[model samples]
Target: MSTIEEIQAELRALTEQEDEINESLDALLQERGVLEDQLASLHKLMPNLGLIHNDAKQLTGMISFTSQLADNVSGKVRQLDLAKSRVLAASLRVEDVLDLKFCTEGVQTALHEESYEKAAALIHRFLSMDEAVLQLSEDAAEGSSLKQSFTTLHEAAAKLRSLTHSKFDSAVNSGDVASVERFFKIFPLLGIKEEGLTKFAKWQSAQTSTQIEV
Candidate 1:
């Protein structure tokens, strides 16, 4: 499978296709659910019809029961077929979504390790960077207090801003883990009591593990 960046790029290019596929699958699922409901309704009706047919003394009662059964059975079969088609389409869409989701996981991992090269592949993905960018826009960024979430990445980003306006870009562009590690060490708030930093460190570890090409 493609990396997260690659998959995201592909998804952008094939948005229409994905939408069509999803719609096809969704319609089928909804139809199937309706059919299941109808089937249950028919089951309930059948028992009632059985009681009436056995108790009725008139010929009209037998004819009415047979006609009702015929209508219900025929309608149920048609509904069941429609429902089956919807379920099949939904299964296919699930596969497509999973494939794309796997790719997303890869890109997220790269960002955790500060792999700017991998992260920068999809310009669209940067749309998600706004919060991080705006929050760090203040050149006087100090490390976030332990009270905030993502304290480690935030602190690292701030120290990065202090070092250079483009420190993260430069270090990540160089593609050296040692430099990345050094950058992390110098990031603000490492000396603070924030557990967010400790938690962000786990993402970094996971990224490093995935970075092994083999």
Candidate 2:
């Protein structure tokens, strides 16, 4: 069995590889008409989910899995075939203890629906701790592995850290309820500024209304 550190390193590598795959496959998302036609044909022919995802879903699954692993939100990285989104999501959930597998679950016994702000904070803390672990491991290690691993971790953290502020700003400035809701939706898991976001939304809406009336 691989040690946690080894697994972490593997996850970092996967993040980089999956990022490339995502870029290439993202183009497919624009081809919905042809894709739908193909899917309908397949459905008429009697089909199950594909044994493997086309590059697009596979790319999404890989990136999702890698992101979860890097997040260290779950206790284990579950197995997943590329074609199954739920399987991919489930595997990612297992990677981070903070991931809140189901954002909506049962009673108070369940994680009592964390506010988006709260969820984002938890994710932030988990990310910080993960970074610390990687640093410590590097300090304790005596090879290229440690150096390379720490560098990878630092890069990943940089990318993830910008998530909250960017989304919050975009949503608030857009003055769209949907955007605000989207921001909140990501908040619990993103550790964003909900109060400021709300205030900004309110202010923007008021200003817009005043301008219209003027």
Candidate 3:
């Protein structure tokens, strides 16, 4: 071949290599454009992500506070319940003490008025009262006053028994029907039904014998 023909062939080969390099550059430029779009989208989302992180921190703090508040409220409720129970117990104790005082005074008044049934009823109520409760009141508050009232009531009961027996005997000897009936009914109230019945029967027998002799 001639020298001019060889040079033209070399120039054609160089032109083909330049076309391949331009295709590669175009592909790289498209890839760079996609990366720039992704970066812009990430930048837009960053502020929203920061806000979500702050909201999550606030919600966690609120949950912790709520739990602490519930615990405190529960403790306060228990304390209130315990205090209420104590107040109720103290009120009951005071009521018992008042009842004791009233009974002591009532018994004395009934005896003085010769209201045997009323006195007996008061004594029965006194007997029914819990001794332990009375003792507890004395130990806690009333002390000697409660003890003295108890002693007075005991003596008063014995005296009332003796007085009733004497009155019943006097009524039988005098043949006072109303008085005998009154005293007989009182004996059952005083918890001496059997003794009252025996004595009444003996009196009836003696009266029958006297009538037979007459």
Q: For candidate 2, lDDT tens digit of each residue in 60-168?
A: 9999999988766443333233446767655543443223222212111222352344444444545444444333433233445545534543443344336545665
Ranking by TM-score: 3, 2, 1
Per-model TM against the reference: 0.21, 0.27, 0.52
Q: Clashes per prediction?
A: 3, 14, 0
lDDT of 1 by residue, 59-136 (tens): 777789999999999999999999999897566544433433343454456557766444333212322333443344
Model 1 misplaced stretches (Cα beyond 4 Å)? 1-13, 55-214
Which segments of model 3 are wrong by more than 4 Å? 1-93, 208-214
Model 3, 81: alpha-carbon shift in Å?
12
Q: What digit string (tens of lDDT, one per residue) describes model 3 on residues 93-206?
A: 777778778879999999999888799777776666776866865663568888977887787778877887899899999999789878877777666779889878888898
Best by TM-score: 3
lDDT of each: 0.54, 0.53, 0.84
